[model samples]
Target: MDFSTMIGHDTIKNQIVNSIKGNRFSHALIVTGENGIGKSLIAKEIAIRLLGKAEEKQYVDIVEFKMSKDKKSIGIDEIKSIIQETTKKPYEGDRKVIILYKADGMTEAAQNAFLKTIEEPPRGIFIILLCEKLENILDTIKSRCQVYKLNRLSEEEMLKFLNNKFESLSEDELKAVSAFSDGIPGRAERFLEDKSLMEIRDTVIDILKGICEGKLDKTLLYTEFLLKYRGEWQEVLTYFLSYIRDTLIYKETGNKELIINIDKINEIKDIAEMFSFNKLNGIINIIKDTRSKLERNVNATLVFDSMLVKIQEV
Candidate 1:
């Protein structure tokens, strides 16, 4: 894809383009952002430019490293293989681009082993590390690379991007997508393409409506319904959190424009009326705590049950 098609992060893109034009691009670069925020796209663009490719496709000189399907973390063996690969010259171009996805998943030993290669990379080798969590990357590795962070786009930017990509969608649908994506272009794309995600989002909204209407007796049913999406429970929680956040914002400011979920304004107003600020704050805290527990690999069944009960109480 053309770099111009990208939605945000213009400054970083400009800098990289200028560096490539000047032939002064760094040997090692790190791009950090939340998941689906276009880190990989940026890396791909850089690789294409560096390799003098006219289109976005797999180039013989562009290499990628990522976790195996069965692996939880990238281990030292993989890093060793990458180190060996860097020794070879580019297959089709003057330069070789090595892109590492989920680089933060590299274990300490793996990072230390990879550090040796970064410290003294072969001539004409460019390394790009794509990471979601900057804190997980070792300081030594970060210090040796030029790091760029990608931030979420504004609503206006997101609308422009969606309009460019999905011309079939109506204005209301576009606005809803902008709200649902929370300024992430990749997420907006997913919401448009993934029907199951839309179902999950709708279910979350329904459950919140029930909660606002004081349907405490359906707490168990809600938990059971959520449990069915255990693999995507985090996303479910995110949807829940987003709706509640919008409700809280509307309640506090009484400004419809200031809230996300704009397409659900009536529902948000109803939810806002059903709960006080303290109650909404309590529910938000509960959702956050539930997410933390899930991330820690706590028992999913128990976590959902407890979370539902707590939210009902709130």
Candidate 2:
């Protein structure tokens, strides 16, 4: 995809294009943003641009390295492999590009091992590191790179892009998908085809409702059901976060205009009233932290159980 195809982060795109055009591109570049905010897309675009387009059955010589979720870090061996690849001459383009997705997941040792290459990067090689957290990286490493921060897209921009791209969708379809996308274009795309996500979201909302009504045991049934989809815990938490955010909005504004869960406004109101603002905030923090830890490979059942027990106290 071209840089223009990216939904947001215009400033970053322009900066990168200017850098490439001026032959002043940084050897080390870090792209940081929240999940669903197009960091990976940007990284891929930059890589393709650097590598240039390739013909059929021809190798463009671009290397992509993703941090392993199971390992919770980029291994030293992988870094060594990247270094070896970087040492080679470009196969098809003027420069060889290496895109590292989830560089923040790199272990301390891996980061240290990578520093040598960063300090004296190979000629004609451009390295792009994509991450969500900048603090997780060493300061010396960050100092050697140009760091670009990506923010969430505005609702107007998000809606416009969705309407333009999904022209055949109904108004309700657009609204529903837009709300669930939460101002992220990549997420909006996923929401378009994800028929099962709404059902899972409904289940989460039902669990929250049961808790608010003092039917705490009902969460156990939902929790069991959630575990059945082992790989979907992240998606489940994302929906849960959106559900709580909608409830909080309804509570604060008392305006249906801002409510996304229109069909379940009553339930949102009930939960919003049952918990104090501080309690709700704390629960949200807990969910966010639990979700992060879950991404780092914490057991799903254990995480959900702990979250349930903690939320019950509120």
Candidate 3:
């Protein structure tokens, strides 16, 4: 993809394009951001452009490695191979581009090996490292590389982009997609892939309903659900928090635009009426704290139970 195709991060894109135009491209660069924020796409586009190609599909000498692979824990051997690959001349292009996805997952030895290469990189080769977290990288490696941090797209910008891309979609549908994606373009695209996202969303709402109605025992079952889908719990929590916030907004302002859970607006309205504003605020805080604990590797089951009990009491 070209620069125009990239969504959001306008300033970063301009900087990258200007660097390439001025022939001042850095030897090693780190593109860091959350998943679905287009870090890889932006990195690839910049690499392709640097290699004198308008598109990635036309690049023959470029090598790409996605770090999500089981064998993707970039080790010394992989770094050695990368070094070997970049040392060679480009097959058909002016530059050999190595696009490393999730470079933060690199092992210590691998990072050291990479550091040696970065200290004296190949003249006509470019390396772009993509990572979700910059903290995992070695200080030496980070210092040598230029870093581009991508921010989350704003709500209005994301909504406009989605609407223009999906013109046939209704306003409410677009809003739901935009809100659910949380300004992440790749995740907004996922809604198109998994059309059942609405259903998954409803499943979460049902779980919330069970707790609020006191139908399901919140002791162990909640924790079991969390453990079963550890990766998705964060998303579930975000949706829950957004739904509650929308409900509260609807209650106070009576505005539908502020409500994200449009499909269950009635249920949300009931929930808003059931819980006072202070209670809702407390629950949101509890969920946020629970999320932080989960990130710190706390026992998921225990966290869920404790959070559920606190929320239930309110």
Report every candidate's CA lDDT: 0.88, 0.80, 0.80
Worst 10 residues of 3 by lDDT: 214-223
Best by lDDT: 1
Q: Which of the predicted structures, 1 or 2, would earn the higher lDDT when compared with the native?
A: 1
Off by over 4 Å in 2: 52-59, 68-70, 228-238, 244-255, 265-303, 306-314
TM-score per prediction, in order, is: 0.90, 0.80, 0.91
Model 2, C-alpha of 139: deviation from truth (Å): 1.6
Tell me the tens digit of each residue's lDDT in model 3 across 140-235. 999999999999999987987787688888878888888888889888887767645554577667666666676547434666656666767767
Question: Of models 2 and 3, which has the larger TM-score?
Answer: 3
In candidate 3, how many Å is residue 43 off? 1.6
| Clash tally for model 2 | 0
lDDT of 1 by residue, 219-244 (tens): 56877778788988767988988888
Q: What does the lDDT read for residue 11 in candidate 1?
A: 96
